[model samples]
Structures are given as C-alpha cells and as structure tokens.
Target: MPNTESLNVAVVGTGYVGLGTAVMLAYLGHHVTGIDIDERKIEMLRRGELPIYEPGLADLLHASESRLTWTSDYAAAIPEADVIIVCVGTPPLPNGHPNLRYIAEAARSVAQNLNGKFQVIVNKSTVPVGTGDWVTRILEDNAPDYHANRYAVVSNPEFLREGTALHDSLYPDRIVLGSASQEGIERLRQLYRRLLEQDFTPPEGVPRPAGLARPQFVTTSLNSAEMIKYAANAFLALKISFANEIAGLCERVDADIEEVVHGIGHDQRIGHRFLVAGAGWGGSCFAKDTAALISTGAEYDYDMPILQAAVDVNRHQRQLVVSKLQRHLHRLQGKRVAVLGLAFKPNTDDLRDAPAHDCITRLMELGAQVVVHDPVAMEQARREWSHLSYQEASSAYDAVRGADAVILMTEWQEYHDLDWEQAVASMRRRLVIDTRNVLRQLPSDTVLEQIGRRRVQETHALPMLPVGASSVHV
Candidate 1:
C-alpha cells in the first residue's frame, strides 16, 4: 500500500481538463477545490450537476463529493491550497498560435491570492513550449514580495481523451513532471503517490487494465514537457492522415484498405492503433496542436512539409465527402441529404473542428437540403451551428427518412447497430456513404460506399498446397 497524506489542491478552470483532474485528485483522497470564472458553471457544479458530458465522470464526482468543492472566487480556493493546478483554455488564433490570455489571467489570479505557505503551481493546460517559464515570470511579477519564494512552477501536461477522460486520468500511460524546483516536484509526486503506486482500488466502471502495474513517471525540462504534449498529438494526427492517404491509393488500385492495414499492422514497428481511414480527425487537440506546432516552426523560419501535408490532406478529406455526393447524384441541388452524427467523435458532445460542419456547409452551399442527427450532440450543434440552415432529426432512423443519400460521419455505436434494411425502406433513395466503415449489413439492392475501399467484381484464390506438403514450406 502507498503511504501519503491528503493535501488541499486548487484547480483553476472547470472545463474538461480541470474537472477531470479535480475529480480524480479528490477520488484519490485529496481535498480539491474546483475554481472557474464562469458563475453559471460553478453554480451548476455546486448543485452536483456536470457542466459537460463525459462517460463515468458524473459517478466519479458523486463518489468523491465529500472531498470536492466548487467556487468561482480564486482567493477562496487558492490561499489555503497546498498545490495549484492551472487548466485553463489556450484556444487557437487565426494565425494558428495558441492564445495564452487565459493562462496569463489564471497566473495573475494565483499570484494575487498567494499565502505564506509554500505551494507548487502546476501548468496542466496544453500550452506552447516555454509557457512554463512565461507563467513563472507572470507569477513572480505579480506576487507580493513577502511570498517571493513561497511557490514554484511546474509543467504537467494532460493527455486525456474527451470521451474517456476519467478512465484516462485514473489509468494514464504515464505521468510527466517537468520542473527546476526539486522540492516542488517532490510535493507533486507525493500528491500523486496513490496513482504512482496504483495502490487504490479501481473505480467501479473504469476497470484497471490487465497488467497496468504502474504508469511511467517521466521527468524532463519544462520546455521539453510542453513540447511532448504537442509532439504527441501531432504524431497521432500524422498517423491518421497517413492512413487516409493510403486509403486513397488503395481505392485507385482496387485494393481493400482493411486487408492492407491488417497485413501491415501486424509488423512490430507499425502497430494498429490510429491507422483508421475515415472522414478525418476532428477534436480539441489534433488540429489545434498541429497548427500550433507549424506556427511555432514558422516563427523560427522553419518549414514542416509533412505536418503541412497532414493538414492539407485533412481539409481535402472533408471536401471529399461533398465531391463523392456530387459524383453519385451528379448534382446536390434540391437533394435531401441526411448526416448522421454531429460530434467530432462518438460518446462526447464536443463539435470543435468537427468534419460534419464542413460537409454540411458544403452541401448547403451547393443547395442540398441537409438534415442531421446525433445521440447526444444535437443540442450542442444547434447552439453552435445556429446560423446553418438544416433540419434536425430526432433519431438516426428519422434522419434517413425520405433522404436521397445518407452520410455516416461519426462511428457511434447507435449508428453501427442501426437496422439498414428498415432505414433504407424509409429513404427516398438507397444510397449510403459509410465514412467510418462501421455499417455491418445493408439491403442487397442498396448502394454502399466507403473511404479507401471500392467494390471489386472478381476474386482470385490462392493455389492449394499438395496433400503431403508442409504448410510452412516456402
């Protein structure tokens, strides 16, 4: 069993990262105060209501209710805390650089509320490299003289996926800590002792992995730590783009992408994880982080052709959806097209950079009558995409009713389990575009299309081995 004492932790920003971190820390027996500037969000949290949607988060919050506090007042939460975690938003600007205004404001608030007690300020927000140093300067300039040495800054980037954020937090692949202050690092390490040792019982829904003894404890310089977050996200985006490129080639060559991916993925160096060819990746991280990295490169007079190509390919992929529609229907004008799934990915209502928006925009521009549906993100989409003129469907089946063509933009389980036969019966036409390649079966007369795959008419069988020949013989 791990030996540790509960400490008071103040988490700034009650968004996805902040809420998940605060809840996880509280679950580990720490007294955590979740601070956000938005009064409505704070009030909702205080009333035991979640401001955002994430699987297993509400239950975890309920489980850790005794140790958790919610407030908008920084002074009320920061002064008595032993550790302060900054998890504010660093949204992207038009030029691709991350706007650090929120980070600066959070730092100033932390500085203004500093107490005599020594505290470690952790940067849990995904900022550009050298942000930790910038945050340190901000705190120092704004903090009172008497508390000059009372706090230390550390860069601790987050790697939580939105849909499964709680599970990712409690069972991370690794925990990265980057700081110059040894004392600060030690205190942060102790704060995560239960996680480091994997001593606590796993939460009810988030079962521990089969052999996840402990997560790696990666220590590095503050700049390296920040770079790690950007690099990791950029690489994952590249992998997906690469797969999409291969899928394009496979279509031209009349080869199945699924078979090709499976054959190459078996090799040790090329494991099958994000090798999926789909509509394209869209979330809070990939596009923003890759753009930030490219922007950082441009600042240093550097050109990254590969990363630029990834971005270009992703944009083209979204446009390709419209192109495919035009190819099949000859023209989109007056055609009723149904789009299934609005969120970037399934299980979360985050529509930031969602491909569905781009596809819908193009379809509408070409005069197609568009209708859309998502299990959980319709309200979010209605709010953010209010300007777009489109019909909203109450269910996937309803979306397809009387539609000329259906595009499955997101791979939700609900879409996968949809009864294609029944759905096709309601459609004006029997055309389906499976961007995610998730549909199991369709009517025999229905026309099905997918990315990186084409219908082949002929099948060639391998030569049979001799009766007495060894199967392994070359």
Candidate 2:
C-alpha cells in the first residue's frame, strides 16, 4: 500500500473484465500493458477511446497517466512483465460446457513468450473448477524447459457488476486469491494490498458504496476459488427465478408480489438484492454460469435439479412477455409494439443474453412489428441483433410513440425519466406492461400491468379500463 517500486503487469484481452482490471491496476501505480489480438480494439484504446460501456473506465484510463498502455504485440508485452493476467472470455459451448479455446490459446502465448524469470499467471475469467490446473498443463506443454518454480497459476475470478465495475474494483467487497503456490499468492496479495485495505483515494467518478465495510481478503485453495464464482452467480440466478415464480402465483391469486418480497426481504437472513420480479434474469454471468455449473455437476455424476429448473424458468420468463401481449391482442398479426431498454441491464451496452432481445424475437414470430430503444446500448443492440427486424428508436419516448402496447425490459434510469403524459398520449392502445416494475404508475388515460403485483401493495394506480380495452394483470 506504499509508494514503493512499481511492478510490471500485462493483461491479455481488453473486454469488460480485462479493461476494468487494467485501468484499476494502472491507477494503483503498476506499469500495465493491455494486450489483445483485436487490432481495432487496441487502436481504440490507444486513441483514448473506450471500446465498451463501463462508467468511470474512460476517466481512469485518462487519469492513469503513463501507468497504462494498450497494444496488440504479445511478444513485446508478455515476456517482460512480472505478472500476467489472463482475462479472455470463456464462452459457453452448445452443450452447456465452457469452450475454453481462448484460455488455452492465452496459455500457449504466455508459455511461448516466457522470459525465464519467476512470474505470476492469474486467471481472472469465470471458468470451470479445474481450469487452473488445465492452464498449468498447457504451460507445461508449451514451455517444457521452464520448471514449476518459474511460474505459478492462480484463480482470481472477478465479481464486478458491469455498471459500477470501476468502483467495485477500487473498493471490492472481498478479494479472492487462490493458488497452490504460497509465493504466487503472496505476490498477487502484495499487488492488491492497497485495494484490500482501501489505501488510495478513489477517482472522481468512482464513488464507494455507502457504509462500505472492510474488504475481506479470502486466501484459499485454487479449486475452491473457482467454485466460489460459479456458486455465487448460480445462487443469484436462483433468487431471480424464485421471484418470478412467486410473481406468476401473485397474478393468479391477486396477491401483490411487491408486498410479499418486502415482507420476506426485510428479514435479516434474506436481503433484497436480486429479488425483483421481472421478465427474467439475463446478462453475461447468470445464464452462462448456471448452465456451466449444471454441466460441471453432470461431469461429476451429480444432477443439479434446482439449477436446471432455474434455467428452464429463465427460458419461460422471456416467453411470458409475449404471452401477455397475446392475451391482450388476441390475434397479434401486425401490431406496433414498443420495447424499451435493450441491454441486459441498465448502465451496460452489452446485449449478451438480454431478455429484451428474446422478447423482440418472439413478438416478430407472432407477426408484430417491434421497435426498440436504449439510451446508450441502442447501437450495440442493432449490431448484435441485425437479423431481427426491429426498428431502432432514438429515445424511450420515441419507442412508445404510436405503439400499440409498450413493454419495459431493462430498468435504465433514462426510461424512468419519461414524460408519461406525452408518451402515453401517443400510444395507440394506451396499455403499459411494466416488466421490470420500474414505473410508479401508468397515466390515467392508460391501463397498467406489471410483472408481479395486482394493485394491492404498490401505488401503481389501476383505474377502470375503458370499454372494450384489453388488460392483463401478469
């Protein structure tokens, strides 16, 4: 935590997790070189342009001064660094297993470029339990001359939320460092000592959460650390599935899920975090991790029924939105449907496993003309989902304008700031289905429908519908 000699660090891959860590390490006084195979991404970072949408990352990149640099030359960046962190993506395969091609290639590159000096190789991506050993094996195969004493492989899975990654990294809730080599653990710990103890002052845009407790430094076994990442995400995904299941029941019985969640969430044992009833849980972490966990369980001859059910429920959750629309408009063969918020979540431009994209697809299947909008993720949405025929809107209001029915998927703050009076005035049917439960209430001229509740606990005004107007409580 002192202003001692800086260590040389090389981070491979400049995606969300990789870039966030690189910027934070550079600001912590380490000389960091971010290496990637993508020349376009490298050029963007070299020109002080952000390739992804993460808050405070650009500021940290500019504030890092001479500590951080991005390049595509692995030979120049990898061999000389004291520590190399592999942050490449481990995308899920077709059968739910993780395709670790990137991890294998990264190990091959690092081994081929070894400098014959003691160095720490940390795995920051969310991979399987035995991936640490697999990476070490790849190193052994590629760099046969180097002995075990020359390098150490460690599992240091990331727990960053996309929106607040900068703040989360600078002041983490906990730091998990797992390795078989004590020397490797100590070196990584020294690199993270400042963050572990909250030593440095955070940058301008990065705000530490209120009442932030002392960050816990969890030093344990290599495989234990890998399991921690999967377990944490699988549990969060389970909570979301449970909340949606309760919402389904709440709709049929006319009991509000908002009050139910409040009553249960207030208990000390069960806190209110991912307990919101919504279309479904979607993002880079939950679905991918849950599926991989189930696949890994199967490898051990264990059947994870709960986790499997969670996956099934998530698939059904997206379809629930389409069912609501179908119930309202019986013959959905050409309806102007507006979908607000396209990204998996607010504050991220990532559309990986986003529920809104699935909803748009299903609407199109039913012959509905869908229009989409997101404050910052609209461009990414169009690029990712070009196969789907959905017109992109400049703003949330523009999406809702002349829409037969509007569905809210992502809970961006911009979507919450809509002028409901004018927005609903332009709707053709004046029916609003709040999937994320974002809006407090609908306009008096419209009929309101949300995911969980039915006008019992929440103050969402449920006025009598106009004659012949269709409304769905779910």
Candidate 3:
C-alpha cells in the first residue's frame, strides 16, 4: 500500500486535467499543493469553488482542503513538494503542432525552484514523444549546481475525460508510469502502492470485480508511455470520425447506421465505447494530441495517413452539420436559431475546438440570431464568443421557445430528457436539428433532422438510415 506517511506533492496547472489529478492524489492520502498562474482561478480554488464543472470534483476538493492547497506561486509550492507533476496545457499551434510554451515554462518554473534533494518530476500532460527528454534537458541547463542524481523526470500521461475526470482518476483501468530509470519507476510505483494492494478499500459504492483480477500497473520507458496516450486518443478519435463518415454514407442509401454500429460494436474486438456517430470529436485532447502525434510523425520522417484522415474527417464533420442546417431553411439569414449545448461535450465547461463554435459562428455569419444554452458551459461560451448573441436559459425549452430552428449541439442529459411536447408547442416552427443525436423521443409537431442522416418529419415515428449507403439526398 502507498505509505500513509505524509507525501508532499505539488501539481502544476489547475485546469480540468490538473485539478482532478491533484484532488484524487490528495484523497489517496497525499498532501498536494495545486499551482496555477491565474490569480482569479487560484482565489476560486482557495475558497473551495472549482472553476471547472466535473462531477464529484468540488466535493473532494472541499473535503480535502486542509490536505490539498492552491497557489499561484509555483516556487513556493515546489520546495516542499516531493513529487512535482506537470499538468500544463499544450495548445495547438497555428501550424497544427503542439505549442509547448506552457510545458517549457512549467519545466523552467520547476528547475528554478529545485534546491533540495531528490524529486520525481512527472509529466502528466499530453505532449509530444520527446518532451520528457526535452524537459530533462531544460532542467539540466538551468539547475547546473543541483545534484543530477537527486531528481528524475517521468512520463505518466493522463487519460481522463473532462466530464469523467475524477471517476477515471480514482478508478483507472491501469496506471502507466514511464521512465528510463528503474529508481524513478520504483518511486512512482511505491507512491501508488495503495492502488496496487489487495486489502486496500475501493471508493464507496464502487463495486469491485468479484472474480476479475484487480487493475494492473504498467511501467515502461517514457517514450512508450507517451506513445500509449497519443495512440489511445488518436484511435478513439479515429473511431468516432470513422463512424461519422459511415453515417454520412448511411444517409445516402437509407441504411440504419445505428444498427450497423450495434452489429459492429458487439464484435468483442470492436467494443462500443467511442463508436457513436456524431457531429465530430472535440474537447482538448483529441485534436491537440492527434496533431502532436502527426507532428512527431513528420519529425521522424514517418507517415500517419490514418491519423491525417481522422483529422480531416473531424474537420469535415463540422461542415456537414452546417450543410444540414443550410438544407432545412435554404438560408440562415434572419433565422432565430437556438443551440442546446455550447461545451464540446457534457459535464465540462471546456469549449476548446467545440463543434458548437463552428456551428454558431457559421450561423452568425449567415445572419442567424443564435440563442445558446448549456447546463454549465454558458458562462464559458459568453466569455469566449462575446460577439455572438447568447441567451442563458433555465432549461432547453426556454432556449428553443419562439426560435425558428433549434440545434442540439452538446449531448447534455438535460437535452436528452427535454420535455419535447412543451418544447414543440412553444416553438414558432416545428424545426429541430439533432447534431449529436441525443434525442430519441419524437415530438408531435417538431421536425427532427439528425446530422449525417435523413430528416424525419412524421408523427409518432422516426426514420433510421441504413449503414454504408450512397447519395446525399438526405
């Protein structure tokens, strides 16, 4: 089991990925200090107010406030920290490669503050393959007097979804630690021995597998660990884009893509996790990490045509949503459009490369008066896209009320469970676009047209398209 003795750890970055990691580690009996550059965000965290919207995160942060601390001062936190995990963002550059400025700054920040003994510096951010080496080089360059043997750089990329980050962190399928040094690997493994033990209690209400073997901890070289993260996300994104591409074909020949997905998903080898056809995959990880992998491929003189196709398909999926809307009204000008969700996906307020951004922006350019609503992401939407007209509604019904057309952008459960009867009665026209196909129930008056599928305009019935079909008539 992990040593119950106090572990002084500092987690850099307080964004969704960082805060979740810090809070989970703190809950696992570690004294964790969270560091971020934003003063306002630091204040919010200090007051036990989580800036992001992940379920079970705020409760854990509030519960562990004494054991967990927040600070904007990286130098202050680093000295007392035994393990410093870098969780900084690696946003995509204009050239479609990862901009490692934040990662570089974070490494420099850690180097400047290192004065004492051995510390395990773990990179939990999704970065390029060689980042661990680069981070090590930076530390070596800056900390000339610091003992080389006193510190180690490790790669442990996070695989948490923004919405289910806490759950994923607390009960991961596997915890991967990548470092060339055996000592570094052992340090990380010892730190997480609690998770690897048999007698250790699992979190409350989380059912342990009766006969199934407990999750394994995989340790390897830093390069393998980094590649694992990129490979996993890229493959999932590829699956999503592939399903979406199939949905487009299904629309043409009137084949049921849902049934096709069901048939394919049941194939044990092709499990049904990310096979749902939608507008496209978004959020921070998929795009940035995929681009990073492609960049790495370019750097190594290798070809990743599959990843390139996945990126291309995702971009095209957004355009397909816009094209579907254009078909309905012929012109978006002077139309009152209501968007149901603004965040990339449900349960998080991250709007990075969200499909809604493209849909809303295109609608606005066409003169559509767009009214937007999300369960918790409206505030972020308001801040990012101030030029667009956004209305904060109490519910999805309010957003759609009196609108000419409504688009289901983010697949929030509230939108899934919306009172369709009331919504249709309140709307001027019975027009609705299910971009994510979150709605299954049909309203009496509303015309529900799913993206990558044909329009269904009948009472008490919905049309299902066939898979791998031809033609764009839908």
- TM-score of every candidate: 0.94, 0.95, 0.92
The count of backbone overlaps in candidate 2 is 0
Q: Which ranking of candidates, highest TM-score first?
A: 2, 1, 3
Candidate 2 lDDT tens digits, 1-474: 234856899999999999999989999889999999999999999899999998778888998847888888889998889889999998899989888999999899988998888989999999999999999998888874879888999899899999988877888889998899999998998888788777687787876667878789898899999999999999999999999999999999989898999999998788899898898988788988999999998999999999999988889989998887776667778888999888888899999999998898888988998988888898886678889998888788788877888898889887788877668766777777789887885555576678877742233433333334443232
Evaluate residue 303 in candidate 3 and report its C-alpha lDDT on the 0 to 100 scale: 92
lDDT of each candidate versus the true structure:
0.88, 0.86, 0.81
Evaluate residue 197 in candidate 3 and report its C-alpha lDDT on the 0 to 100 scale.
63
Compared with the true structure, the alpha-carbon lDDT of candidate 1 equals 0.88
What are the per-residue Cα lDDT tens digits for candidate 3 across 1-474? 244655798999988888888887787788899999999999998888988888777777766677888889977899878889999988889777888899999999999898668889999998888889999999988763777677899999887888877667765688898998787888787667665663455555333456645557988888899899999999999999899989989998987678788889999999898998988999898998888888878887999999999999999988887787777667878878888898999988989889999988888788988888889987887788787665677778778777777888898888888767667666666677888876766654457788555555544532222221221111
State in Å the error of residue 371, model 1.
0.8
Candidate 2, poorest ten consecutive residues by summed lDDT: 456-465
Model 1 scores a TM of: 0.94
lDDT of 2 at 274: 88
How far residue 354's Cα lies from its native spot in candidate 1, in Å, is 0.6
What is candidate 3's TM-score against the reference? 0.92
